[model samples]
Target chain A: EAGVAQSPRYKIIEKRQSVAFWCNPISGHATLYWYQQILGQGPKLLIQFQNNGVVDDSQLPKDRFSAERLKGVDSTLKIQPAKLEDSAVYLCASSSIKDSYGYTFGSGTRLTVV
Target chain B: SQQGEEDPQALSIQEGENATMNCSYKTSINNLQWYRQNSGRGLVHLILIRSNEREKHSGRLRVTLDTSKKSSSLLITASRAADTASYFCATAALSEKLVFGKGTKLTVNP
Candidate 1:
């Protein structure tokens, strides 16, 4: 099966700039997740979508980070006025079931905020 | 927030040796999963052990879950250099939220 797909494998932006990352989940997946991973740290959940509706976004920094899964297929994560601390790998994952099956992840977008 | 905590932040072993990583978490969980992430790559699911199941095996990977102790262990037998990567343990709670821990960096020297 095809794996989750992400674009712009790498991105570099100046602090206070805006950047967006796109992700296409695996076919037939109903749940999509966005995670942020800092250097030498574990991936932290940024947001979660069950189909097109959000199921969780408690960890997302709404002031800067926003995510949307439109049409319940693809998702976009955007960071406005990016901060230096926001430089990290943004990962996307999808699962056939919510919290039941294993997730299939995309290679991720390595965002560098200068 | 992170739920699981992996021990021995790093491990270095020679090929053909065995490497074991342990994870401990608080609160009750519905299941626990193991994932591998190669440098510059996304995480790949390695295995999953439910709260009811004590253990599970996939290929050369063995995972043991002890709910009573709130801990789990991942043993990689006959490790190969190709197996070098970061291993993470994630817990799925009743709320249906999956949380990951600080991963263990494993290096298998050939």
Candidate 2:
């Protein structure tokens, strides 16, 4: 089976610029998640989707971050007006309908804001 | 806010030695999971221990959960240089959020 896929392994942008990262999860996986991982820190959940419907996004910075999983398949996360602090690895993960199973993650997109 | 916190933020050991890391959480949880992230790579699930369970093991990895203390520990026996990475403990709280700890950076010297 193929693993989760993310686009633009690395990105560089200036502060206040808009950036978007895309993710394609494993086939038939029902749960998709987006997370931000700062250097030397663990990942922080940004959003979660269950079959195209958002299950949780409490940690998401609504003012600048938005994500969508259309048709319950591939997903995209966008950060507008990026800040210097937003420089981190954007990780995408997927799990089966059964939440008990752990997640499988993609390689992630590393974003650097100047 | 982060729900879990790990102690001994960094650890170094020689190959063939044992490494142990501890994690403590603030609230009740349904399960706790351990993951490893190599440099420049995404996280890989190492093990999962449910709240009702006390211990679990996979290969050289051993995880123990103490619900009463709201803490868990991961022990890597016979450590290898390939095991050099960041180890994180994540809690699946009642709210369905998997909150992660700051992580423990492990360096295994060959």
Candidate 3:
């Protein structure tokens, strides 16, 4: 089986500019998630989706960040007016369910906002 | 508010030695998971230990969870050079969100 796939392994943008990241999860997985990892820090959950519906996004910055899982297979995360603090590795992961199972992560998009 | 915090931000050891990393969390959790990430790649699931379970073993990796202490530890026995990477411990709360710790960077010298 193929693993989770993400686009644009690296991205460089200017402050106040807009950037978008894409993720294609593993086949048959029912849950998808987006996380941000700053340098020397662990990943912080930005949003989560289960079958095209959002399961949780309480930690996401509603004023600047948004994400959607169109067909429940592929998802996209966007950040508008990016700030220097937004520069981090955006990781995408997928899992079969909400149980104790672990997640499969994608290569992640490293965004550098100058 | 980070839910998990790992101790000894970095670790260096020689091949054939054992490497141990510890993680502590603030709240109750359903399960705790360990993951490894190479330089710039994504994280790979190493193991998962449920709250009701005390210990789990996978190959050279052993994970022990102590719910009473709200902490977990990952032990890599006879570590190899290829084991050099960042290891993270994530806690899955009842709310279904997995909160991660800052991770420990391990460098295994050959």
Candidate 4:
């Protein structure tokens, strides 16, 4: 089976600009998650989706960050008016209760704010 | 705040030696998972131990969870150069989110 897939392996944008990342989880997986990982830090959950419905978003910087998992198989995370602090690796992961032992993560999108 | 914190922020050891990393959490958890990240890439799932499990093993990896102590330890037996990577432990609380620790950087020299 294929692992989670993410697009735009790398991106460079200016402050106050906007960028969007796309993710496709492994087949038949119903739970999706978005995480932000700064250098030298563990990945932090930005949002989580269970079959297209949100399970958590409390950590998301709602004012600038938005995400959606439409149709329950794919997801997209957007950052508007990107800030220098928003520059980090965006990772997407998926899991299921029946297979909750672990999660499958994407290679991630490395965003550079200039 | 419920994230796990790994001890010995970094570790350096030689191949054929045993490597151990410890993690502590502050809240109750259903399970704890360990992951490995090479360089700045995505993480790879390693081992998962439930709160009820005291010890588990997979190949060269051994994980021990102590709910009473709210801590866990991962031991890689006879580690190899390929085992060099950043290791992280994540705790899954009631919120269903996997809170992760800062991670431990391990360097296995051959």
Candidate 5:
């Protein structure tokens, strides 16, 4: 089985710039998620998508961070006017429909804001 | 927001020894899962124990869950140098979101 796929394993940008990360989830999976993991901390859920609709995104910084999973297969997370504190790894994960277990994660995109 | 707290934020052990990490959560959970991350990269699922399960074992990893106490423990037996990584416990309720702990940094010296 193919694993979740993320693009641009690493990226560096100056503060206040905009950056986008892409994620391709496993085929047939209905649930997709984006998480932010800072150094020495656990991964925090930023948003979740069930199919083409969003299920949860309360933690997302709506002022700067935005995510969308269109067509219910691939997803993208964007950070505009990035801050120094936004430097962290963004992880993408997927799971089958109605499955609470067996979450497959991508390698993640490491963002460094200078 | 985090639902679980991992004990011994850091741990160091020699190869052939055993390593144990504990986690305590604040709310009711439908299941608990453990994951290992290497070099702050992607995570790999280790094991999942449902609320009804008391213990589960896979390869060298063992996980025990206590719903009454909202706590869980992960034990790595006969540890090897390759076991070095950060281990995290995540708890999930009826929702799809799984609340994760801060994680435990484990170093198994050869």
Candidate 6:
């Protein structure tokens, strides 16, 4: 089984610019999650998708951050007008709906907002 | 918001030594999981202990969960330099959402 895959291992953008990160979850996994990890801190959940429908997005900054998992497979997280504080690692993970034990994570996209 | 809080924020030990990290969380949880993240890499699942189980082990890792105390501990025995990484504890509440702790950065010197 392949691990979760993410693109653009690194990204740099000026403040107020827009950027997007993509993720492809493990095969057959029904749940996907997006998390933001700041320097010197743990990863925090930003959004969660059960198949194609969103199961949680309470922590996502809807005003600037938006994400979608189309066709219940690949997911894209976009940040519009990126802020300096948005410079962090964006991680994507997936797990089996029947097995809630743990998640398999992607390498992540390191975003630098200048 | 983060639910679990890891203690000792950092730890340093020599190879072949044991390193123990602790995590305390608020609210009732259905299960607790441990993850390891190497610098510039994604996290890898280490172990999971359910509310009913008091202890579990995987390879050289040992995890103990005390629901009565709302705390858990991860012990790495005979740790090697390769074990150096950030360790995080995530608590899954009754819901499917998992809340993570700030994490403990461990350094195993060879």
lDDT of 6 by residue, B1-110 (tens): 99999988999999999999999999999999999999999999888889999999898999999999999999999999999999999998665677899999999999
lDDT of 5 by residue, B2-97 (tens): 988999899999999999999999998888999999995799988889999999999999999999988999999999999999999999887768
Runs off by more than 4 Å, candidate 4: none
> Number of the top candidate by lDDT?
6
* TM agreement with the true structure for every prediction: 0.98, 0.97, 0.97, 0.98, 0.98, 0.98
Give the B-chain TM-score of model 4. 0.96
Model 5 C-alpha lDDT per residue in residues A32-59, reported as the tens digit of each score:
9999999999999999899989989999
- Against the unseen true structure, what C-alpha lDDT does each candidate score? 0.93, 0.93, 0.93, 0.93, 0.93, 0.94
Q: What is the C-alpha RMSD of each candidate to the true structure, in Å?
A: 1.2, 1.2, 1.2, 0.9, 1.0, 0.9
Task: List fnat per candidate, in order.
Answer: 0.76, 0.71, 0.85, 0.76, 0.68, 0.78
In terms of DockQ, the best-performing candidate is 3
Misplaced by over 4 Å in model 6 are: none
lDDT of 1 by residue, A1-114 (tens): 789999989999999999999999999999899999999999999998989999999999999999988899999999998999999999999987653678889999999999
Error of 4 at A50 (Å): 0.7
lDDT of 4 by residue, B28-100 (tens): 9989999999997999999889888999999999999999999999999999999999999999975567999
Q: Residue-wise lDDT of candidate 2 within A1-114, one digit each (tens)?
A: 999999989999999999999999999989889999999888999998988999999899999999999899999999999999999999999987464758889999999999
Q: Residues B1-110, candidate 1, lDDT per residue (tens digit)?
A: 79999998999999999999999999899989999999999999999899999989999999999999999999999999999999999998765567999999999998
Q: Could you tell me which 10 consecutive residues in candidate 3 chain B have the lowest summed lDDT? A: B93-102
Q: Every prediction's TM-score for the first chain?
A: 0.96, 0.97, 0.96, 0.97, 0.96, 0.97
Backbone clashes for every candidate come to 0, 0, 0, 0, 0, 0
**Over the stretch A29-64, how does candidate 3's per-residue lDDT look in tens digits?**
888999999988899999999889999999999999
